[model samples]
Target: MELTYLRTFREVAKWGSFTKAAETLGYAQSSITTQIQKLEEAYGAVLLERYGRKMVLTMAGEALLQYANYICRLHDESKEVVAKQSKGTLSIGTIETLASFYLPAYLQAYRKAYPDVNVAIQPGNEPFIIDAVKEGALDIGIILDPPFSDPELDCSILREEPLVIIVSPDHPLAGQGEIGVEDLENESLILTEDGCTYRAMLLKVLKSNQVTFKLSYEFGSLEAIKQCVTYGLGIALLPRIAVTEEVMAGKLAAIPFIHPECKFYTQLICAKKKWKSKAYVGFLELLSGGAREGDSDAGSELSK
Candidate 1:
């Protein structure tokens, strides 16, 4: 009935081998056997059965596994709540675009408001970043839409940025103020990898329009793509926010798609049962307000 026994049982159930579980839990094989034996003795039931050199769970073990997971989750949640009350540091993950364009302002404002709170930011693409959050490696994440859907995670739309087709200044399409999907038929396209949310949206739009273009290059780095486009390697479709500096410098031109301008939503996601730390709460407020200000700026720019 000890929690240590439950932990051992959970590890055994996960690996389905006493030796493997022992290795994973960093315990001697005899110690793992003893813990399981103690657990079975306490419950007055045989929890595992031998089958072809492997241990399979008995009905009692299976039931205990379920409850063990719940108990562990509850324990972690309780610890997190206590840590937040004590003003512990917060870890956040975000994709590269927001990290580059928005995070500095948000972090600046957050630090100004909560100077004593420690904050850590991890940046990666959506898949890697979301996985970190899902594994409890981060308390919250700001990432592009098409969020990882898990019952334990909650996602809220924070901001929507329009997608634009961009070309180098010297490209044939650069002078066009606005272009339609049909115009890209024979063009060479520079694209992000398949994991990118905005790239997936662009693919869907192309497929729906029956448009065909040569995908000349694919990259994970937005900066690389921008540099390639700057050299007139190929045209790229990117989020408007990602190209602001390039456009301003006249190195690239953003041409809106005439129909159904793709809107990419940035979302704030967190574990459903996570305790909101002071640092996390302050950072979220900064992000929300910054997003609103960004939208207002974009609106005013469009009017001009």
Candidate 2:
């Protein structure tokens, strides 16, 4: 019946462990167990069951979780409204490339406009970011992916991001004007992690062409992959924006990797039903090529 119990239940279901939930919520293990019992008693249904090493939600728990997410979000929103807080926290989930190469200027502008607002940037893979946005854990998500559509999300196409093949300046393919899938035959490749959007696209293109290639290294860090390519370990396919500085500095070479299937866009996504805070709306404006007054410099930089 208490909101605290519902919050505890959500955490328990999230981690699927009473001890872990207690640790997360700063409660005793017994307290977590008590809360879950109270919930089950209130609902007149068992909410969770042990499945092997982890606790799994029962059918009743699954249904309650859906409503719990909405309830918690609404509760938080109500506090913001009642307090009339001008500065609030903005949570964003995005992939590494956009987080590193793309969002910096916009974030800077957002900070200038809302100096007291706290910003949290969580870097994750595409699917993780998308799901976090839908589940209300993230305020917004920015990703570079092929065209995407979700009925529950409001998606906007920001711009096309060109994918490129990167190599050390001294590598054999460095001077090439453009490269094709066949050019990768018998080549070694340093690539991003498995769930990366562009990584999946690159793999699909090579597999369809039947190009014999070696996976030299797979990394979760974009800088790590770039360093590997810079040292002549292998070539890599990445967003052009990610390697712009090194390429312009003559430390790396970027060749246009042309393929119909290689097209990708930088996108913004938010849950359609979520309430927009002032800070959230301000950041959205920056992303959409507008800026707050007296913040024209940030706007000009982002508009480029």
Best by TM-score: 2
RMSD of 1: 16.5
Task: Flag clash pairs in model 1.
Answer: none
Candidate 2 global lDDT: 0.88
- Once fitted onto the true fold, the runs of candidate 1 whose alpha carbons sit more than 4 angstroms away are 1-87, 146-151, 258-261, 292-304
Candidate 2, run of 10 with poorest lDDT: 290-299
lDDT of 2 by residue, 1-304 (tens): 8999889989989998998999999999999999899999999999999998788899999999998899999999988764544576899999989888778878777777778888999999999999999999999999888888999999988777888999999988988999999999999999899899889988998999889999999999989999999899999999998898999899899999999998898888999999987778777877876323333354346545
Query: What is the clash count for each candidate, in the order shown?
Result: 0, 0
Model 1 Cα shift for residue 219 (angstroms): 1.6
Maximum-lDDT candidate: 2
Roughly what TM-score does model 1 have, to 2 decimal places? 0.64
TM-score per prediction, in order, is: 0.64, 0.69
Candidate 2, 112: how far from true, in Å?
1.4
List the global CA lDDT of all models: 0.80, 0.88
* Model 1 lDDT-worst window of ten: 295-304
